[model samples]
Target: MLLLVSLFGCVAAVGAVGTHARLSPEAILPASAESVRAEAVLVSRFGAGEPHLMLLATTSGSVDGQRAATSGRDLTDRLAADPRTAWVRSYWPRHPAGLRTADRHRALILVRFRGDERASRAAGDDVVARYTGRAGPLRVSAAGTFAVLSESDRLSERGLHLAEIVAMPLVLLVLLWTFGSAVAALIPVAVGVLAVVSTTAFLRLLTEVTTVSAFALNITTALGFGLAVDYCLLLVSRFREELAREGSTGPAVRATLRTAGRAVAFSGAIVAVCLCTLFVLPLPLVRSIAYGGVAVVLASVAGVLLVVPALLVLLGERVNRLDVFVRLRPRKRTRSAEGAGAWYRLALWVTRRPAAVAVGVLLLLGLLAAPAALTRFGMYGDRLLPHFSPVARTSQEVRAAFAATVSDRPSVVLLGPGAARSAEAVDGFARRLSRVPGVRRVDTVTGAYRQGRRSALPPGPAERFTVGGATRLSVVPATGPAPQDGLTPEGSRLAARLRAVPAPVPVLVGGAGARLNDVEGVLADRLPPAVGFAASATFVLLLVFTRSLLIPVKALLLNALSLMATFGLLVAVFQEGWPAGVFFGPRGAGVTDVIAPLMFAVAFGLSMDYEMFLLSRIVEEHRRGASTPTAVATGLQHSGRLFTSAAVVFATVTASLALSDLLHLQVVGTGLAVAVLLDCTVIRALLVPALMQLVGRANWWLPGARTKDRGQERKTGRARTP
Candidate 1:
């Protein structure tokens, strides 16, 4: 309680001070256009121009029109003090509706730099120092698109809190329902709490080396709480069954330690491995997500193994009391009659009906996934904020006023030295860029130079055109904020166009477009490799664990089938033009993210946890030489309840994640929810044994004569050499 209070207090202080979280400049400021090739383009576009760059600060908010507008006078006075600051402006209106228009509160401060690059940067530093906190309480905040999004830090924070508030009770309900004891719930929840703290401390330290995203809190909390809960639930349920059978918590814990503990260890390792695959994408957001996920998984494992068990040892009977369901007492252990004869009945049924179930599941997912195909993609980052938000207003206005042409987008280009900074050089380069399609507008600082245009100069960074006497030009294409996935056709076109630039100057085009292009390129390039990694490794591990080549192969094939169905569904809802506002909630008519595939791949493997756990006992029984049908029946009987419970745990976490306003959250939440639902109901329970029965001995095949070396060499006792 003390710690919770302290943490909340800190969050409140930061929120009150208004800088606990801030948007990354990259996320907020528009990316350089797809057309830009040279940094000079950025330098020229708004750099040397009549100072289009401005910092409009208000020590006030929307609450009071009179008092906030009055700050404009104080702002004007401060502006008058600095000679280098010219045309410093602020739009403070006395009436609420007056300043509420698109243009209000966004002011431009025209700067006069005294010297060169060093001087200008120094001046910028001074500008920040002078203006940053000059105003008092209810102080000045930033106003550019990025600045506006930074302010939405509060909203994202609120989102995380909301997800937790809604998710926890449901999980507790599941725990209570599972254990029939209030005390048992603490084991998992406690472990999760510890995970949360340890991860926060680690992340807090990591913040010193590098910045953490605003989503860090949400990520850690979700994962920490999720893993703790799931791992604990898995272990606790097993431990309870052991206790009921043995009539002693000690023996129960030991059996659980040997059995469920082993399963937890295996699942934890896989989840960690799967989450680590996220790093394969090589993006900051992805890396952060990986870090957060790994921490959470570890925390969950730790909670289940170390903390929950330890607590169980400490307070065995007492833990049961907090549980409400126990008071009711069941006459006997709950078991469904249908599930009783399930293994043989299910096996025979499935061997009879695999195609029907497969078709049904595919058709269902196909219907859900149809929304993503015909979709277009765009991110209204801060626009997702409510109408009351100031940042939302700021973003709306800038986008409204700015040039809609692709050339006007903020972009950067890379070019070598010793190039011409003249109209002839620039026009030749412009013609080259102009020819390649997707090149909306190409403006060479050199062309601006020869034409004697200077208003665009300061903003344009024109003079930097000649690096070592060779000229470089920056191109700007007008576009909305670039896509995060970076693999879209737009990203592809930008890269192709940059290569197509016929510049004697030797140019490398990039900025927002190229950067995103690179991101998309890496994703496309690496996804295959990651899939190979997962497939080969899973096959090897499953083969060794199950000692059945056919089972492993079939397992992987089934997993792949489920994943494809998931992707199809993702494409349907996010990529195709479906009004996702119904289920996934509030999404526009567009396809989902490029990274969605990778995320699903990694997450699907994790989602496969229940399947692996449910099948392990059955497969082990099969290795002991039971008939496939008998083994399937026995395995489902023992594992079915846990499978149902685990799926519920996964779904709860997923639903919580879905509640986050971020699209990334929505993608993960949706994929996980659908995949888990399918894995539990359609894949694990029915598909495994059916497929196994169909293949029989082939399921345990080994290659070549070497197969004789792997399994018990069946003597000539069964049959003489044919």
Candidate 2:
């Protein structure tokens, strides 16, 4: 009753508080970064930079002509008339030729809203709901930064529902097949569902104290379902084993708790430690995922350890009732003991030629991991969506027609007080900025300069550049090939040059490119510390769990091998667009998303998860006085099936996520699925047994006080002095 009520409470709370979850791009950076500070200056001095909303107005005729111009004018005027907008600008009337498409049938309307990010998103959503679609001869659709973000949030919600609808039934069927009993199959699903609901409630509570990304929901569901099912499988399988031995529910539960429960606890702890390292990253998106990861792990642990065990105790022998798929396999094969199983035979075969097998597997992994050296990182824009999408089309249109417009969107340098105090100084700085390579133009309060020549200043607001006491220069990057993902080399180079130039006052370079550069910097700077801390935490956990110095180090090295191989495969398939016209398509960006590091974090944790399960069994066998080779083979036999099933289930869940229409989600799902599969098969099945054989007794060696004590015991056992 208590468990039932608690689950109900979680569901109820989720329904009540989930609405507060937000989608934000600002969540990617700190509010105090140089780019953020530049934005603050723009917002306070000029009503710019804060307006993230935009619209792409298209028509059948040339946007430069009078008809399309008039329609665009009317649309912009109407939008500007709204109380929410701080300002609105359109290319049709004043800058017709520059903003129109090459075919001349499309134009852009840039709109800025009043207030902070949340308020602006709300206003933008309202505007989009009200004004998008046909208007006069022009068709207006919501596009640009906020539009893409809003649409992504909508798709995330729908995709979560779709993943659940598709994954749940498939998981149930797989579990039924694995267990061969309807009653046993349903238990893990129940625990998974409970964990998901409970995690949603936890995220809702987290939102009250700090900003939680809507993106977190997707991760929460994935982690919750995958880990919950894994934990339940471990517990249920162990419970059945104990039941066979003890012949009663009570002793079986006790023994299962003692062995499998400890493994589950350590597994969860290791994964949790690995994920918690994300907190060391400076981005809110990573931190939010960390929050979600930790919450779901804890929830899954509770459901499996507390709820499933109690229910098992009540069900007793009936836990295996309602046999289904009974005749799917031969009884002898299905009910094989540890040493009699397929994995045991395979382990024995591999151990016979341990050195050769280990060397071959290592060579294969090395080749697979080689491509990761050429991996490029970048933020994914609308390129993640199909080119047919309105958001994606608008992005392409903007890149084509108005690539060099001196709007608030371009790379900018904000000069502090007295940097460009005089008109001559401002003009000289503008000329110097234009001379820099990769800079298409520089726009300042005085005039716009292209290729070191000042262009005629059109009549407009002079205060746009000169705000408060500081002067701003908008530096347009020369149009070029698209970046791999988030990297904008040209923009980054321009920003760097602008900063290096001598100035009378302090200068802060900012914009999309600079902001992305800062994001990359934050990751690079924090990576060493984050990795060190996570490794230390994982090592401590493994040391306590295995009580062997060499084993934990071997485990870490094995995880690294699998992870590097996974990364290499990802780079080849996703970044280089291998088998291009099929899996990724022509629209493939030919680069990995900036979020690939996050995938590595999650995959590494999952690798440790399987590692813990396999090692725990091997350590147990070794402690029981078995020789090293015998323990390795027996451990593989006992634990290989368990880890394999968990991997299949986990891979199934994550692969289902890959079926999402969203590209980033697809990357996440595929990356994790591939990592889990490799970890289970190549690493666990072949490499682990072979490597353990090669190491022999040294695999269980412990150093320091324990080693000295063991040495003394060995000496005292045979008294040659007597």
Candidate 3:
């Protein structure tokens, strides 16, 4: 056993060594979407794509002044000269009004890189590092898709390191208090470390075959420590309980594996199943999270089930040594005697007034969930980063300064064998696009148009748009830059309206706004099926485990309610930015991040983990000849502290994510913390007991089974397997 553990540790250590560097920071988008395909054509055929990097050059005087123009020209020349840059467009010399701020003190330079998303990000990083500070008379800062994503990646890595530093010691303290033994407490922490290392190795392997988002590293680490501690807590607690009863090590370990081991396996499988549902969503970010989440869960279960039992066998009664809080420790009691405990008493009280308790709890959950209806969804962007991030600050400055810039506008790509052959048709299409409500101007190969008229000849090289019989039109919006909150409702509507416009050739809309719109549309189409699969799969698993139709149905309903309430709170905290300065530091985009759906899937799985923990014991008690009410009370007595402790520990670990600079991470962390705490407290403590009491023996009903009298089973002292 020791040799096996050592081998596992060594393998994990090797795999984890450079895992962080292997991860990618590219934005999430569906590869097969029309917008993405348009982007590909622009990159491959036109030798230009959407600008991945933007440099804002600010001057104390007018940007048209000699000093500013010279500096700007020099900056543009440097960028254009770089082999990494596919193309560079600048305000200098040409003096396009749209690229210069209204006050004429700032100018924008847009740059596209020569390769894929990863290559673009790497080139953007190098460019930002080289020219972001100052060039001649201008102060330059980087902001754009790749620049912002790169900054977020750096900050996320730093934040995760800091979170681990802050979280681990606190988790250990909580574990010590819960176990009252320094030695036993360290055991779960060890298993948690193993889980994280092993999962990191798994993710490293994944990155070799497919793109894995750097954001997934956060989930991997958080779930690794949280779920490992949870599973080990159950195993260790059960082992100790069995030890006290059997007065021998071998039987105690065996019984622990039989009871708590089954729960661990089921809980892990359920969590993995829930995460796997994300595979149905086409977004790379969501799929990567699913991969990381499933990997960590499986690693955690394996570590706890194998290493923990081996340690228990080796340590025996000595597992209870080093009791740090011996003075505070309560006297050991039998499972039957524990019925007089607080949780058991609470359960009995809830069962006695089942209807009223259920009504009141449901009402409270309803009120908490009300805010979810008000949520507006948007893609995450630079604004979600910390205020101090240069990329975020630059984006804000660009929006405030420039009246219109190419970075925030959508591009229309007309594709065919002779799409650009007719100048009249191209001009007519450009004129109509320019007349759209939100459009400031439409620049095509023929010329530039504004408000249904030809405004000017093309400002830059027309050949850039006319490549291989394909024409690209840049549609600048009248509303300045795109909103900092990402794809706004207005942006989506504009994309739709533009797509509806008549065109002579096959047109594909591509740009930040269009990509976001496409993502939301795809999610809307795919989410229902993914959710249905998750729900049906979870129902089947619960039915098989509990062997009762009503129990599985009840569990599903309760979990859904808990998740709804969680989303409601998230909408309030993140979207509404209510109770400001408490959680997230600033007001959010007045919209929920698109990542919320991913959070929902993960949190639902976690809620079910606790549900299974409690129900497993309840089912065991019911099979052992106890009445419904008695079984509920006894189950609470046996498993209440176990899951509650696990929830608290899990909450503690996730709550540390609040310290992250990324707003999405903060939202995810705070949302999960709130969900777990609310689940263990109001939902599990009050709702489950009350609802089960109202249902009575019907809770355990199964089809095709002989109905036995409870009195007969009690008299015979016979137990049946669920």
Candidate 4:
């Protein structure tokens, strides 16, 4: 009791420390990327790379009217006066006709902040809270890159908190239903709490060394609890079974540790190994999840091994004593026998129709996975916010009011050293850029050029382009409809076209399009290595554990199939916007988020974790000289209840995240839940058994194994060949 109490207390201390973990999440571009460098140059030179906040001033009359114009100017003046603001621009002063809505009742106010992202966001939040609602003659609202993101952060935090609150009681209920004893159910929940607390502390420590994503908090808690419960379920269930057979505590624990404990350890290791692949991703968001996932898995494993065994030792046979819900009590001997017999019968049934079962399951999985070929990967924008949110509503109104006249923010291009900065060079480059298909205007330090015609530099901020022996150009694209992913088509085309332009110096295009392009490229570039690393790691681990070549190959293939099917569902439901009622937020971006592949890897690894459990028992039985068919049947009978129960708990915890308003979090949560369910039911239950039946003795075949003469082996009293 003292030890358990001390351990729990330690976890609490660590969790408190963990609360200080900093979240320094980045956007599409890493700081070192060329696009980021271009953005940095612009921000340093011009005091603005992009508008941090876009305040919309709306009125019942034309924005050009005296009343609305005066109010708009007042709002801009107040915004510009804020110490946190670097500068502010509005239609009333500069381009009233150009910036006004077709309906003439709304205008945009673009504001830039004067510091690093963290400081700027902190200061921007203050500005947004103060200025978002109302002003004389005009109702003011805010939504831009920064305002939208800030709102998302708040919603994500709230959603994560809500998920935890809702998931815990449901998890407890599932545990109670599964174990039939309140004491048995409570033990896993306790282990889950310890895992979450310890992982939080560890992640906090990790933050001191490197950056962590705010999303990691959500991932850590969900995975920590789910994994802890899973490992504990395996341990407690096996311990109970041992007690039933041995009629004592110590020996039961020892036997359970030798078998079920070993399986839990391997499963935990596999999960950790799978998540490690995320480290290969260049994105901070993906890497943080990997770090949190691995830490949580380890914490859960440690809690199960250290804490659960102690609980088992203390409680002994009494682990089954508390049955608060009598109707949920464990089945009698006859029922237990029937379940095992049913699994055995089920395995035999699959064996008789192995070919048909294999073909049918594959066809269903293939059809389910077909939509994944159409998957589009991009960043989630303001569209992910709830439709009723202030930011979301404001953004929609702003788009409706001003989208037709809104000028495309020019893609800023940075020139490398030895680049020509002379008037002649600048003129020649500007003229060439203006000829690019979508180029509306090209502004250089020297002057602004449009359609190959040179105009003297405007009286405003054009000269800010020259700095540090390098020069920049704002290549504005012709105005039109932007792409659904938020990168305007002209901007996207302009970036590519600008890159292709032969310039004397090297060029780096930076803006929304460039940032997204870099992000997509990085994900694609890193995907092969990440997938290779995950697959190779899984193969090596399974090979060592099972010592069979075929088993690892089959497991990998099946895991891939289930994951592919899940991805298809995600693409169809989230990207294609199928059955749209439950999918809150904007219509799909016509693509999954860029991080979907990473989620697939993580899900596949988790699926393999359960595969390890099932195979461990089957392999054990095989080595004990049980025929391959009997070994497979007995192993399924032994592990089906535990694996199914664990899957339910894991799916429940992850599925809770779908309630998040952040579409990215929703994708992760919903996708993970679907993957786990598919693995538990279709893959583990049906496909795995059928595959094993078809494969027969080859499932356990290792290199250099002699084929026993059945009669000779039996006559010699040696272990029968599998």
Ranking by TM-score: 3, 4, 2, 1
Pick out the ten consecutive residues of candidate 2 with the lowest summed lDDT.
Answer: 483-492
Flag regions of model 3 displaced more than 4 Å: 333-336, 423-441, 445-464, 478-486, 501-504, 706-716, 719-722
Model 4 poorest 10 in a row by lDDT: 483-492
TM-score against truth, every candidate: 0.74, 0.91, 0.93, 0.91
Kindly give the number of clashing pairs for every candidate.
63, 5, 0, 0
Model 3, 1-722: lDDT tens digits are: 75788798888889888887778775388678878888898888887676788899988988898888988888889889999888888997789888987788888999988866667678888998899887888999888887888788788778778888998788877898887688889888788788888888888998898889877887787788778778888888899889998999999999999999998998899999999998998888888899889888888888888999999999999888998778887887776576699898999999999999999999999999999899777776776788888888888787666635544578899987567788888999999999998887899888899999998998678788888879999888775434422276667777878988999999999876787788788788988898889889988998878878898899889988998898898888878878757757667557777667578777888889999889989988887877788888889877888788888998988898888898887888888898999999998899999999999888988875425545556678685532
Question: What's the alpha carbon RMSD for model 4?
Answer: 3.3
Candidate 1: tens digits of C-alpha lDDT, residues 651-709: 78776766766555666777877777777777777767566666666765766622553
Those runs of model 4 whose alpha carbons end farther than 4 Å from true positions after fitting are: 1-21, 25-28, 92-96, 328-330, 334-340, 404-410, 416-420, 431-441, 445-464, 478-497, 582-586, 705-722
Best by TM-score: 3
Error of 4 at 172 (Å): 1.5
CA shift of 667, model 1, Å: 3.6
Cα deviation of 424 in candidate 4 (Å)?
3.5
How much does candidate 2 score in TM-score?
0.91
- Candidate 2 local lDDT, 1-722, one digit each (tens): 54674667576466645444444543788777888888777766776663466677888987767877777777777887888788777784577565566777777778888877788878888888877888777888777777887777676567667877887787777788776678888887777777777777776777778777767776777778778767777788888989988999999999998988999999899888888999998787888889888888887887788888888899888988877777765665445464667777898899899999999999989999998987766666665666667777766666555654433244455465565467777788788888887777788888889888898582256677786678888776665464211144444455557667776567777776667777777877998898889888899999988878877888889988998998888888777777656875664565566667676777888788888778877877665556777777778887888778888888888887766666787778888899999999999999999988988877777766446544654575631210
